[model samples]
Target: MSNATNPTAEDAPPTTDEESVSVGTWLTVFGGVLGAFIAVLNIHITNASLKDIQGALSATLEEGSFISTAYLTAEVVIIPVTGWLAMVFGLRPYMLFNTVVFALTTLLCASAWSLESMLVFRTLAGLAGGTLIPLSFMLILTLLPPSKQAIGMGMFALTATQAPSIGPTLGGYLTEAFGWQSVFYLQIVPTGIMFLILFQGLKKTKPQLELLKNGDWFGILSMAVGLGAMIIVLEEGNRKDWLESDFILNGTLLAVTCLITFVVIELKRKDPFINLRLLARRNFLLSNLVGIILGLGLYGSVFIMPMFLAQIHGFNAMQIGLVMMWIGLPQLIVVPIVLRLMPHIDIRILLAFGAFIFGLSCLLNIHMTADYGHDHLIWPNIIRGLGMPFIMVPLNVIATAGLDKEDVGSASGLFNVLRNLGGAVGIAVLATFLSLRQQYHSSHIVENVSAYNPFTMERLQGFANHFGNLGADPILAQEQALRAIDAIARRESFIMAYNDCFYFMGAAFIVSLGFIALMKKPG
Candidate 1:
């Protein structure tokens, strides 16, 4: 009963002959990609709105953080399974159902009366929405001929990369103007249109019910438990102080046990949920390694830049978006150029240059200071924009290009999962580094600011005099002056810590260059 043998018609992709490429094909791609776009975009659109959501629901900030965490947890867990789930449900019905569900969840999230309800809706949104990214990636393979794939992937990357860049800006404006509910509302129209377009042609893609009986339920359970537990740990680890906390300790143990169990179960299972067989291939393995690093850079920076802008630069979400746009818009020119070069050049060279450029850009930010703002970010971010497509498009092409048609689903799913997981891990690392480094920096700076030093004495006296002149009591003046100097020192320490983080982040990009080197260009 395992799908390893006796492949069914349902295992094959639905195809139209060369003679009659119908409008339905276009509509199908359009529907699927648009759904994918909105789904990916949703990951971040609600990002800038979380504070408002917390205020509206009267939930503590910790509870509000789960809105994104739950969504991402569901998303990462569901991504690898989507390929098989789609085939089991029939791609058309599966796609259509998820689109409707995702759209509905947006409405529910918008209307949620409490944090608990919002978490449920957001998780559902992730469950239904995460499938679209890898689903659409494989669909492009099925729907388009080899010649058109680069272009299809180009557009997909553009949407995936561009949407998150501006998500905060869009969320900011909507939350500022109409309230946080508007962020959820923002995607409804796009999702609705996606559903309507797919509703017509998707029925033609038949379901394979036999897959239901042969399904790897054990594998599924293991994956869900493993990934869900792991993501929760990563997302909350810093806040909970890592393995020291009971919650984090248990989560870590569960994650390790389940993931190890999942891998063993998968290796031995005859039609595994995720198709571990693909990882044996050299190109696929190398490409996925690159994917993880790229995700760390892309998602990690996306997380950090906004924190830098909103927390330090005093920018609103919209203003942060304005700067983030520099990282995305250049892709418009870069993608087309990368596509053109793919046939003529070796992909490894492109990847090396791209990775090097991105890493160098990270190094450039090591110069960040309290005064750095939009003007300081422009060229480095643009360089990052140009570097991204070269790395992503080539890596994606290399990953799936060598894969067999049937393997594309599993490979795509795995590729996306690693990338999403990378993002989560990257953010956790960034957050932890900032928190610990901030403390270390503050303490180290304070150690040198003692009034025993001439500079310290002068600075301390100046603050006390300024406060005394402003009508503070003598005792209160000294206290206020001390607090004021401490605040300045703390800010300076934070800036330096961020500078340190950039150097660490840049190291990730440099490491990726080795993976790119190891990937053999598909002959």
Candidate 2:
């Protein structure tokens, strides 16, 4: 079946036993999946500990934010290029080197004395760790035959669906019990185990150094600059007031120009480093489209929940983590069932069903009240847990179904890139929206609660009398009454705004069903 006329196929590794893949191949895939899980887990691990880290480093909230931003920006920039680099250096040595770098950088992040030092170390770590995600994806598709792909997809699901859900939980617990630094140091044992497993499992292949000369250097530069700038704009844009701030304005312009240049370069080049043409395939493109919404809901929900608990219910990190576990833990049981169901199911139906349930979970949160607490959140989180595996596992199979071996690397890179991009965009939109809605709700409440309203006056006088009963001076009690009213208004406004955010995410997920309709059923 080997075709000498097809250079791409010729370059592909020799076909292995399709019916019975070796144990080593499974082990290699396991290592890759584990690496991907670690990479993704790191993204959210710092979230629960950001305040502690900020205090320790003597950094402001805005300055501390860069710790996450640095990692995300570098990760987004490096992902698309990973496939090409792996090809050039050979996957074994390339992955091992990056793993080592990732391990070292983990230590560096732990030992960082200042925000600047942390950002540098984080960026380096992101560059190294980013490779794991796409490479793991490429490994599953290239190594496993169709029959076993469901199992592979199930394992990969843990990384995509489970990792984000579990990250805050783990980090919160660790920070509470051990300290903020433990979150970084936590990776050490896993990294070592991962290194050893990968070392043994992966068969060595010669580096295709000749491929370097043909590398799409211009495209690479454009993509890196473009993606990096885009991430910065999204992460910092709201806080910096979008295009109003000079930094955000300039970053937006740079991102636009560079990304446009990248697209033009990619489309024109015959042997582009990463194949942009794979998007022309219907299933691949549609799967990616749905994936954007997936990321939006996934990351956006995770970001919003902790803030919701902290602001409304006054939950600490550990308490928030405990509640969040409803979203994370059930997947262990659910994904196996999903894997079993995959054979008999039409994956398109499964994917759509998953999307629907996930959206339903968000919609369930739309009625959140000031009193909404841990018990009220459980069903929605568990529903989300069920829905995620259905979405993630099927979507992976659909996207990669008809792809050729040579194209898997590029496809993997593009697939991962879009999901991360979606996450960035989602976080930005939700953050901005939350602020705007809060203002809107607060203004409406303020306008309605005027002296002209008897009910408002009654409530105000009641509060004043209550404070006066606590032995405050008459004037002081009146002032305290006004402050209390304002606080109530503010709290209620925030609750409404948060409800709006949940509704927005739910609508996004439901709307994504249209894209799923466009996808061809997996063969």
Which candidate gets the maximum lDDT versus the true structure? Answer: 2
Q: What are the per-residue Cα lDDT tens digits for candidate 1 across 441-479?
A: 899998999868899889888989999999998899999
TM-score of each: 0.95, 0.97
What lDDT does each candidate get? 0.83, 0.88
Q: Over the stretch 133-212, how does candidate 2's per-residue lDDT look in tens digits?
A: 99888778777788888899889888987778878889999998999999999997888888998888776777778777
| Model 1, C-alpha of 209: deviation from truth (Å) | 1.5
Candidate 1 TM-score, true structure as reference: 0.95
Off by over 4 Å in 1: 1-24
Which stretches in model 2 have alpha-carbon errors above 4 Å? 1-15
Candidate 2 C-alpha error for residue 28, in Å? 1.2
